[model samples]
Target: MSALLDQPLLWLVVTLGAYRLGLWLRDRTGAHPLAQPVLVAIVLVATLVVLTDVDYASYADDTALITFVLGPATVALAVPLHRQLARLRGFVLPLLTAVTAGAVVSVTAAVGLVRLLGGDELLARSMAPKATTTPVAIAVSDTLGGLPPLTAAVTITAGILGAVAGPSVLSLLRIHDHRARGLAVGSASHGIGTGRMIVDHPVEGAFSGLAMGLTALATSLVAPLLVALML
Candidate 1:
């Protein structure tokens, strides 16, 4: 019953099972962009949480193990990056410029759109870091006097959107350069998009992992200054 639903182990199993189902669906669907495994898993987990009436706070706490694993997972992206170190060095200057520009544009567009839509300053601030990774976005939102949890949700949504449609969009634009594509996706979508790139294209994923880290640093510096001016 309620007590059974509260077990951390049960939730962990449920989370993994949901992801497994998502993977199966993705394979069955021929790996369509819309069939993204994480997106599917999110949908499945959300449905289950609502059905079980489990509060988000308890669910998150119960699933803390997964959160801890994310740190190492992020660090592991370095393996592929290390393999690209030689090429990375040659592109350092351009990559830095691209990431910084992307960070500025992302913050400006998010904050501007929110304000234009009549959202208050608090909401606009919360939306400012939506393009960055979750932890960085949450921290930036908190520091800007906005709600961290709201920023986290928005950040994840943004990431999912980028992962689902970014590659196709690049293809449409005739952007075939893997480096450029990776930089664009990682700068705009953070870890989730980078994860997609990692699975679909290894070289792109290496550059994407590089961009994700750089975007975090760039956003951290750019957000405060940019938001201050806009607000």
Candidate 2:
């Protein structure tokens, strides 16, 4: 074990191996409703970290190569958006309204709830952009004097919760419009919910991709201003 830990490359191989195992489980289970691959991977990794008594920083160091891919993966979302450009043009106003409204509600509600519960300024700020993607969320948190790590954790939690419950919530609300559903999911959940959307509704998936990109851009521009005003 000490030898494996000493060789950082071994750690990388093991982490990727675990990730692939999780993905294979996702597929083998037919991506079952309960078999969330991200959740599975998180559980697996967490368990391994705990059992091996490996600190998160050490594990993260080994996985930096995988983490580095996130930037390009996020940028790749553009392909789906570009493919749906025509539909996007027609629904521009509605999409903008939905995304803007969702972002405002999500941020405001999170901050308000935390504050009402006696959370400190940092906690409130961290919750401010929990619905946005990691990069935007981290920026927002920093501008607001929040802890970036807390914001990142909140963003991941929000994404996971959204991915798990978004479709059911829409169903309960009787929301049949694919475009509206897609916009809401993307604006609220970011990438994880977008994954579930892609499997359930291709059109919604495309629209969600567009929404995620647009919302990230909008939040990155607006969040700092909002934080400045509030503070």
Candidate 3:
């Protein structure tokens, strides 16, 4: 048991096993909000960490195998985008415009609000990419001299908030087009909102996927230059 605990591979297996168990439990519970797999995995892993007195670095080392799949998972989103190429072609201009505008607003508003509240410059910089995906957000935060950890926290928060409130917000404004809805949610919220989009409107799922990739690419190109000019 001690030897198993000591091996990084064992730890990796345990963490993933726990996450899968959490997912199973979530599904069996009929997808209860409180039983969210991500939330459960976090609690379970945190408890294990505390009990074992294991540091994050050690846990991360063990779990790097799983983390390494993130890139491939992101790329796999392209399959859906490709499947929906005909739909994509029809709204190319509007999609691009919405994504660009939404990206700019999300970054600017987050950073500006944080700065107004007397947040540190690094915090402000981190806020600039809080609306995008982890890889892009981290890169943007690093380039802008922000704290990556804080950026990650903020990005997750932004995604959750966007997912929770997005549909209602759009409905209140009477914005009913699936394409527009998908673009807005994905540009502002990334994966989490995309998940919610899939549940509500499958057509939106394709556009959301496309928006996520395009927004990441666009933001990656523009955020650094904007930060440089502003700073």
Which has the greatest TM-score?
Answer: 1
Best by lDDT: 1
lDDT of 2 by residue, 105-214 (tens): 67668777887888887788888888888888898788778899999998998888888788789989999888888888888889887887887787788887777877
Tell me model 1's lDDT, rounded to 2 decimals. 0.90
Ranking by TM-score: 1, 2, 3
Writing each residue's lDDT as its tens digit, candidate 1 over 1-231 gives 987996778888888888888789878988789888889889989999999888988888888999999999999999998887877757888999889999999999988999999999999999999888899899999999999989999999999999999999999999998889999999989999998898778889999998999999999999999999999
> Which residue pairs come into collision in candidate 2?
none
- For model 3, the stretches where C-alpha displacement exceeds 4 angstroms are 1-4, 32-35, 168-174, 229-231
**lDDT at 110 for candidate 1?**
89
Ranking by lDDT: 1, 2, 3
Residues 1-231, candidate 3: write the lDDT tens digits. Answer: 566577868778777877788668867986544454555666788798888888788888889987899789777777766776887666788878888887777767777788788887787888888878977898888988899998888887777677767877998999998888888888888887786677667778778878888888888877777667665
For candidate 3, give the lDDT of residue 106.
71
- Of 2 and 3, the candidate ahead on lDDT is 2
